[model samples]
Target: MKQVLTIAGSDSGGGAGIQADIKTFQELDVFGTSVITAVTAQNTRGVIDVAPVPIENIEKQLQAVGDDFDIAAVKTGMLFDAVTIRTVADSIKHYNWQRLVVDPVMIAKGGASLLKEEAKDSLIKHLLPLATLVTPNIPEAEALSGIQIYNEQTRRMAAEQILKSGAQGVLIKGGHGADPDFTEDFYLDQHGGSLVLRSSRIQTKHTHGTGCTFSAALAAEFAKGKSIEEAFLTAKQFIQSAIEHSLNIGAGHGPTNHSAYRHYAQKEMIRYVH
Candidate 1:
């Protein structure tokens, strides 16, 4: 079986971060491994507290995973500060690992800051260059590119600037946009080609871990030997189904159902055959 690694924080709620990543990996039929950089005391409602792991321990975990598993792809979720970002970059370089997916998780669903303001520069400088694909939401894209994303023109401009940061590609997620009907995610490939993935908006509040799950599914598909475009499409479909069949476990924002994608695909196949 193929293996993938998630270097991110642990979400105690099992709705986002490492928990969501692992769940998505499992549902996608990949061996899931992780290096927890921090632990959040959070649930559906909000993040009560966060404790960042020590740099030394984080390095040790990465080295351990590298030594044991042949990680086919890797994804990052929340590196709390600049030091952790630098350490993670150095570790990835040392491991000589490619197929890196960087999910620039800056804020939580409850408006809590996951990435420190000071560490944004470190992420762009130390990590973006190493990323095979950097997945950023609108606000994140705006912050990374130092521009406002209002429409297609500005969104494309932000994507271009982010690619100039040395990332091979960028996916600007349109979840935060003002689209009333469809959520459009824009993808800019390394060769300057672009693809737009559109899915009808699901009116629900159970989108706590959408970003983490999308990047995780993307990495899992890559580990399974799918092409970048193929993996991106599968990831989009996965997230869409997961959102449409969201779970209702928490009082606040719940999590998307990771297993819903496989079921949805099976049903679609059956419908197609009939």
Candidate 2:
């Protein structure tokens, strides 16, 4: 089995962050390991508190994982501050781990900020250059690129701006868009390849971990040696299925069903054969 690593915060609700990443990795048939950057006191409703792990401890965790596990791919989420982001970036360089998926986790479902405002520069300057793919939702894309995305033209512009930050590819997720009929994600790569991936919008509030899950699925596919285009398609399919069968476990924004993708795939396979 391919081993994948997630360097992220821990969500007490088990709906997002490392919990969701690990669950997605497992559902995708990859071995999941984690280095928790912080611990959040959050439920489905909102984040109550956050305690960032010490920088030294974070370094030690990365060292331990880098020293032992043959991590095939890595996805990072919720590196709270500039220091944490720098540490993770340095570790990624030290290990020379390539197949990296950077999920620019900026905000929570209930309007809580996940990434520090001051650390945005650190993320773009340090971590993004090491990313094989950078996945950002609409709001995050706007924040990163300094371009407001209102339509397809603006969306493409924002993606292009983000691509300039050194990531090989940029996937701007449309989950946060105003589209009521279809969600259209824009993808742009350094090789001049661009695609508009569209999916029917699932009208549900259980999308707490959609970004994390999508990026994690992408990392798992990359670990399995899938091309960026193939991995991008699979990740989109995985998130769509997960959202279509979303779970209503919390009072506020719940989580997408992590196992729904496999079940959906099985049913599709059976249908295709018959």
Candidate 3:
């Protein structure tokens, strides 16, 4: 089986961050490894408090896995702060691991701050250039590019800027924009080309952890040897189906059904062999 590593915070809520990332990897039939940067006391309601794991522990976790396994791809979520970002960045550079995907998770679904204001520069300088693909939603795109992406044109512009900032590819998720049809996800390639993917927008309150799940699935798909664009589309469909089947369990934003892929894989095989 393929192996993928997700370096991010832990959500006790099991919706976003490492929890969701592991589920994505498993759905794609990849072995998942993780290095926790922060731990959150979160549930269905909201994230209550976050305690960042020590920088040394974070480094050890990365070293432990990276030393033993051929990590096909790596994805990051919330780094928590500057020191933690630096720690993770150093490990990645030291290992020179390829196929990196950076999901710029800035805030939580319940309006809690997941990343520190002071860590933004470090992430850009140290971590982003190493990414094969950087996935950031609309608000995160605005924060990263300092440009207001109000429409498709601006979203394209933002994608260009993000790509130039260091990553080989940029996927600007349009979930934040009030687009009528669906969230128009933009993909800007290294050769200055672009692809926009549109899906049926599932209107539901349980939209939490969607970004993390999307990016993680993309990484998992890439680890399975799919092209960057293919990975993005695979992840898009995964998120869409997950959202469609998400249970109304929580009071606030609930979790996606990451396990939906099991149903899909079984059903697809049955149809193919019939």
Given candidate 3, what's the lDDT at residue 27? 85
Give me the runs in candidate 3 sitting further than 4 Å from their true place. Answer: 264-274
> lDDT for every model?
0.91, 0.90, 0.85
Better of 1 and 2 by lDDT: 1
Q: Which candidate achieves the best lDDT against the true structure?
A: 1
**Using alpha carbons, what is the TM-score of model 2?**
0.95
lDDT, residue 172, model 2 = 89
lDDT per residue as tens, model 3, 22-138: 998988899999999999999878989999998878888988998998888999999989898888888888888788999998988778888888888888888888899999999
> Candidate 1 versus the native: TM-score?
0.96
Q: How big is the positional error of residue 6 in model 2, measured in Å on the Cα after superposition?
A: 0.4
Residue-wise C-alpha lDDT for candidate 1, range 1-274, written one tens digit per residue: 9999999999999989999999999999999999999999999999999999999999899999999999999999999999999999998999988899999999999999999999999999999999999999999999999999999999999999999989999999989999888788888876788888777888999999999999999999988889877888889888989988877879999988988987876212111100
RMSD, one per candidate, in order: 3.6, 3.6, 4.3
**Model 3 weakest lDDT span, ten residues long:** 265-274
The TM-score of candidate 3 is 0.94
The per-prediction tally of clashing pairs is: 0, 0, 0
